[model samples]
Target: MPAIPPRFSVTPEEIDRVVATFYASVREHPGLGPVFAAHVKDWPAHEVKIAAFWRNAILYERGYDGNPMAVHQEAGNVRPGMFDPWLGLFDSVLRHELAPETAAQWSALAHRIGRGLRYGLVEAATLPGGIPKLV
Candidate 1:
């Protein structure tokens, strides 16, 4: 893949834009909308938190301090399968709003995070159930 253009920068402002745009898209999604609505009562506050999360995640700003797994665990509506659609929307927004290399980089990071979150959710659910008996 080509390197990011010299003029292209992944600043906090860009992260904010990506998060805002992605969430706006999510709000309209049928599968994900109700899940978010059930958990997020105040969108403005949630947006700020999500923006900080991306800044901390992609930019390493050290601002986000919440436990994502705990939040996900509390969100009974969110299923492990939802990550695929969530990441799809995220990848779409990143590709549309960023340079090719920038999009690629962020998309990869999002996939990694999504996978980890999904795995954590599943593990939390299964626990000592021990992978079921292989009948």
Candidate 2:
């Protein structure tokens, strides 16, 4: 059987670049910086892990082995409102680091995943009566 090719035009090196650049911007972002800083003590390791995740997502590799939704839910500080700013920053990084068509493709995939993650967070935080949890 033949191996499946990467889904898009991005390379592993490009994924690394995008992950590094995006996280750098995230570390400086007023809305996101503190949240990440609270959890990620080693930026290099986090970037490598995230790069592997992107590789797994876009390239169909098996390098990443974590559940983003579960991690975010367990974090207790990852709010649904944070997805907008996070996606915005990620889109900007994709646009700046990749070709126009590639960026669009990746952004579409990212937005879909972000929406799912945000929905999961919201659903997990809601009460049985459809009301949001105050805590």
Candidate 3:
């Protein structure tokens, strides 16, 4: 594989554009739209939060500062194993729109997100069964 490019920083405008384009596809994605629809009350607010998240994650400009997992968890949308589709949709968006290097970086981040969500889901699922105490 070719060397990944230097992290290409993103602007709010680019974040907005990318997020809008991404969600357009996401809204059509199987296993994604309904999941989000079941949780999000206002589309515009959700859009803004995601845009900010992208900006902060893809850029070091501190554009997005929301606690994404907390928001989703609070919304009762933290279905066990749901991270697969979440990461999948992001991967699809990166593949459809980003440069190869950019896609690679985004993929790396998405993997982390999926892993975190996976563990969180497992923990949440085990809660009713007496989660083991961490040493």
Candidate 4:
């Protein structure tokens, strides 16, 4: 079995802080808010998921085990354009809250994760033979 990397050094507060900052950026982003709003209604609960996601990503914490793309893709939510900026904003938030090395390490994994999410989004957004019809 692969050895776990050193336990992430950030506290929960720092994790929450990163999430808060990223959402603050997203709410202001004209491209992001509508795409997010069209799919997600409750913001507060979503924020909590955001924190859980980051903690799992950065720390190998087990709370977030869902296939990132599968959930988003299967839901048929998420605009294609929004994914890139969402990732950019997340990296910016992490950099603002974390040490340089921490930011770099986390950012790399975030990119890989985001790419998976992007594939899911693309799959959802571009269903063939007209928009997907509910069964």
lDDT (CA) per prediction? 0.83, 0.94, 0.69, 0.74
Better of 2 and 4 by TM-score: 2
Worst 10 residues of 2 by lDDT: 1-10
Residue-level lDDT of model 4, residues 5-71, one tens digit each, is 7345777778888778887788888887776777668778888887887777767777775566766
Identify the leading candidate in terms of lDDT: 2
TM-score of 3: 0.76
Which residue pairs clash in candidate 1?
Answer: none
Give me the runs in candidate 3 sitting further than 4 Å from their true place.
Answer: 1-11, 128-135
Worst 10 residues of 3 by lDDT: 2-11
Cα error of candidate 1 at position 35, Å:
0.2
Q: Provide the global lDDT of candidate 2 against the true structure.
A: 0.94
lDDT of 3 by residue, 86-122 (tens): 7777777777777777777778976987687667656
lDDT of 2 by residue, 65-130 (tens): 899999999998999999999999999999898999999999999999999999999999999988
Better of 1 and 4 by TM-score: 1
Clashing pairs in 2: none
lDDT of 4: 0.74
Tell me the spans in candidate 1 whose CA falls farther than 4 Å from its real position. Answer: 1-9, 127-135
Q: Pick the candidate with the highest TM-score.
A: 2
lDDT, candidate 4, residue 8?
52
For all the candidates, what are their Cα RMSDs to the real structure?
Answer: 5.5, 0.8, 6.0, 4.0
